[model samples]
Target: MLTRISSVDHLEVKQVVFSSVLQLGDSCILNGFSRALAVQRETEIFYGDEGNFPSYRIFKKPLPLPPITESISFLRHNINPIIKVNNIDVTAVSNSSILHVGNSQTVSMEVRVKHIRQLLLEGHEQDI
Candidate 1:
């Protein structure tokens, strides 16, 4: 297989976070995994209590999904092998994401996120 890229004028990538990949060209296999936990509280609370949170415990455990068993095939017939690209502008790629250009054989990605928001008022604040 022959791949010809003419030009890439401008490419702006802001952020690539949490087990992400930005690949250009041919690839045989790509695998990515990410896990995140975000907690927001109205008032400052005890940092040590984070371990008691249920969501925290879940993140500690391994992913509880079955294994992947699949097969894939690709056949490419190019009449004009000249690939032209003027410009590419990207904002963000996050959380086990992949931004790939050209040929790829296999790609796998997984992401898990847990968000908790707490807005509780104490006894004095509740009266007001």
Candidate 2:
């Protein structure tokens, strides 16, 4: 496989987090795993959300079957030996994600999110 780019004018990436990858060229393999625990409360009170919490701790355990363990075989035929791009004006890539401009053999990505939202009304003081 071949990749060619004449011009890349601008590329803006605001944020990338939690085992993320941003590739501009060819790659054999790309693997990413992200786990997050989010808590949102209406009031200013904090619930002490931390890694020690049971929900957050669950991600620490190993996966049942990881992608790397599996055997993979593939054959690629490159009829066109060259890939030409005249111009790339603007690009934005964000978050546990991949942006590849060229050929890729294998790409694997996994994301797990647990979000908890709590609302406290003005007249619900007794509920607490």
Candidate 3:
């Protein structure tokens, strides 16, 4: 069992128990079972290394869900977060927007089989 405060939404995390949810909270969780798409802004430069690099200005717009693969990464800015979960390792590459929690936030979560194995092995089945 593990716990910590998430900087994303200031939610208390109990653990990383599944692929859908990167972290678990009392009310909701951060999910990563799907690929998140973001809007991009392109620009043209006339000077500097712009000639050597790709001649396009790429700015990934902030998204509701940060783009993450393998581990947690590309979290949007404004969402100051600290992920705390046991046996979970996340790597973030870019920063952009905030993941908001409003009145419409859902509470249901899907637990992963791997998380279940870890909990039972550690004798914390009650947590499930």
Candidate 4:
């Protein structure tokens, strides 16, 4: 499993009210990238709710089965998320970028995570 953190700034808005609360949707499918993390296993995504940050719900679903392949399948991809504040769609200026806190404005954050196995043990030649 892998995790990362990134930030963004320099945002412009005319009129937008932020969400005061976050409620998880009953059934919501994660986006392509977030869903990809659930390959063959269920996963939960948590975002924002950091120090003085409002929590946001991404999605709720079971793990998706990855494509069957005889050879080893390598996973390599970066997730670029589009952030939304209080039902306001914030255009992603760049990949994995968030809007900059403007004057007298606030921002909320969110994250997603999925893990299959907790522990795995492999034996090698001359090495247990």
Ranking by TM-score: 1, 2, 4, 3
- Tens-place lDDT digits, model 3, residues 8-122: 4344434433232332443443333322222222222233432222322222232346554676557455453445333433443122212233221443322211111111334
Evaluated at residue 61, the lDDT of candidate 4 is 43
lDDT of 2 by residue, 79-119 (tens): 75655555544344444677666678877777777777878
> Which pairs of residues collide in model 1?
none
CA lDDT of 48 in candidate 4? 31
Best candidate (score: TM-score): 1
lDDT digits (tens) for residues 3-105 of candidate 1: 5443445667888876788877667788888777688877777567664545476666766677768887899787766555567788899889988766667
Clashing pairs in 3: 7-80, 7-81, 7-82, 8-81, 43-57, 76-96, 76-97, 77-96, 77-97
TM-score of 4: 0.20
Task: Write candidate 4's Cα lDDT for 1-128 as tens digits.
Answer: 23233223333434323322222212122222222132231223333332221222334543465676788868667564322334334433322223332221223333344433422234432332
**Over 4 Å off in model 4, which ranges?**
1-58, 61-104, 118-128
Model 2 lDDT, full chain set = 0.63
The C-alpha lDDT values of all candidates are 0.71, 0.63, 0.32, 0.32
RMSD to the hidden true structure, all candidates: 4.3, 5.1, 22.8, 21.3
